[model samples]
Target: MNTQQRTSTLQHSGVNEAEVSKLFRNTYSLLAMTLTFSALVAFGSMTFNLPHPGIIIMLVGFYGLLFLTTKLRNSPWGLVSTFAFTGFLGYTLGPILNMYLSLPNGGSLVTMALGMTALVFFSLSAYAILTRKDFSFLSGFIMAGFVVLLCAVVASFFIEISGLQMAISAGFVLFSSAVILYQTSSIIHGGEDNYIMATITLFVSIYNLFLSLLHLLGIFGGDD
Candidate 1:
C-alpha cells in the first residue's frame, strides 16, 4: 500500500482500539454500579419480607433481561438490558441474603462471599492481561455446561440430597471460574467491543462463584 493508505489504515485501527478501550471502561463502571444496586435490592427485600411471588417474578425477569442483553450486546439496548438484569438479580438475591442472615454465623458468610469475589476477579483479570489469550473458543463448552447445570438444578428440587448439592455447587464454581476467564480474555483480546455485556457476564460468574464457594465452605467448615 502507498504511504497515505498506510497512514489511513493505522488511523482506523487506532480509532477502533480507542473505541474498544472506552467500551471496556464503560462496562466495568456499569458493573460496579450494578453490583451496588443488587446489594441494596437484596438487603431491602430481606428487610421488607417480600413475598415468594415477587422473588419468582424477579428471577424470571432476570433471565429475560439477560437474554435480551446477550442478543443486543452490540447496541445501546444491550446496555439497558444489562442494567435491568442486574436489578432483577439483586431482587432475586434477597432470599439468599435473608437465609444467610438467619444463620448463626451469617457475618462469616458475608466475609467469605466478599473474599471469594475479590479472589476470583483479581486472579482472572490478571490471567487475562498476562496471558492475553482469546477464550471465545470456550463459548460452546460453557453453553453446554450451562445446560447441564440447569438440568441438575431442576433435579435437585426432587432429590434434595446433600451430596448432590455439594457436587452441583462444585461444578458451578468451576463453570463460573471458566466464565470469568473467558469473559476477561474476551475483553483483553478485543473479541468483545461491548464492555457492558462483558462486565455483566464476568460479574455474574464472580457472583455465582462466590456463592458456590461460600456454600461449600459452610458445608465443610464449622460455624464458629
Candidate 2:
C-alpha cells in the first residue's frame, strides 16, 4: 500500500477501536446503574412484604415495558423504559425470594445462587471480551434454545412435572450463559452499537441465570 493509503487505513482502524471502546464502556456503565436500581427496588418490595403480582399482570407489565424500550431505544426515553423493565422484574423477584427465604437454609441457597450468577456472567463476559472470538456461530443455536425453553415454560403451566421444571432450569443456565458470551462478543465485534439495547440483553440474561440457579438450588439443596 502507498504511504497515504496506509495512514488512512490506520486512522480508520483507530476510529473503529475508539467507537467500540466507548460502546463497551457505556453499555457496562448503564448496566451497573440499572442493576443497582433493580436491587434497591427489590429490597424495598421485600421489606414492605409486597404481594406477588399474578402471572397475567407480570407478563403484561414485562412485555409492555420491553416493547416500549425497543421503540425508544434511540431516544432518551429508552433509559426510562429500561429502568421500568428492570425494576418490574425486580419487583417480581422479591416475592419469589421471599418464598425461598421461608424455606430452611433458604438464605444460604439464595446467596449461593447470586454468587454463581455473578461468577458465570463475569467469567463468560471476560472470556468473550479478551478473546474477541466470533460467537456469531452460536446465534442460531441460542435462538433455537430459547424457542425450546419457551415451549417448556408454556407446557410447565399445564403439566406440573418436576423433571420438566428441572430441565427448563438447566436449559436456562446453559443458554443464558451462552447469551452472555454471544452478546458481549457482538458488542466488541460491532454487531451491537446501541448501549441501551445491549444493557437490556445482558440484564435479562443475568436475571434469567439467577432465577434458574435459584430454582436448581432449591430443588437439590434440601428445601424440605
Candidate 3:
C-alpha cells in the first residue's frame, strides 16, 4: 500500500497508519512463523540423523528454492516456496549440528550461540524501528562484503589458511547483523512490501548468524 492508502485507511477505519503498519505487522507475523517452521525442520533433521548435503548441493538447493520463491512471490505458492526453501536449509544444518553436538560443550555452545543471535537481532531491529534510522546507504557495502565473503569461502576449498574459517565466521556475524538492520530498515521505509521475501531475508540472516556464532564459540570456548 502507498502513503495515500495508509492515510485513507487510518482516517476511515481508525487503524493507525494502516498500510505501513499492516505491512510491518504482516511481515513480522510471517517471519515468526517461518522461523518456527525452520527450527522444527532443523530439529527433525537432527533427530533423524539426516545427512548434510554438503556445501555444493546445499548452495544449489538454497539458490534454486530461493529463485522459486521469488518467482512465486505474489501467490500462495510463494508461501509454500518460502517454507520449502527454509526447511531445506534447515535440513542441511543437521550434520553440522551433529558435529557440534559431539563436542564436550556442544549443547552449551549451541545454546549460547542461539542466545547471542536472538540478542543481536532483537537489538538491531528494535533500534532501527524505534529510531527510524535510514540504513539504505549500507546496501552497496553489504553486497560488496557479501561477495568478498563468498569468495573467501570458495577460496577456502583450495587454500587452507590457518585462521580462514574463523575469519569467515567472524565476517558472517557482522554481515548477518547488517542484513538484519538493512532489511528492517527497508520494511520501515516501505521499500519492501512483500513479507515472503522479507521473511526469507531475515531468516537467512539469523540462520547464518547462529552458525557463525556457533563456529566462533567452538573455536574459542569449546572442547579442546
Sort every candidate by lDDT, greatest first.
Answer: 2, 3, 1
Whole-model Cα lDDT per candidate? 0.79, 0.94, 0.89
Q: Could you tally the backbone clashes for each prediction?
A: 0, 0, 0
User: How do all models score by TM-score?
Assistant: 0.84, 0.97, 0.91
167-219 per-residue lDDT for model 2 (tens digits): 99999999999999889999988889999999999999999999999999998
lDDT winner, 2 or 3: 2
Cα lDDT, model 1, residue 212: 86
The CA root-mean-square deviation of candidate 3, after full C-alpha superposition on the true structure, stands at: 3.7
Candidate 1 lDDT by residue in tens digits, 9-82: 99988987788678778877888888888888878877897744553575678677888888988888877777
Model 3 scores what on Cα lDDT? 0.89
Q: Using TM-score, rank the candidates from best to worst.
A: 2, 3, 1
Off by over 4 Å in 3: 1-16, 222-224
lDDT tens readout by residue for model 3, 8-124: 876865543476688788888988888888888889999999899877898899999999999999999999999899889888887889889988889999999989999999999
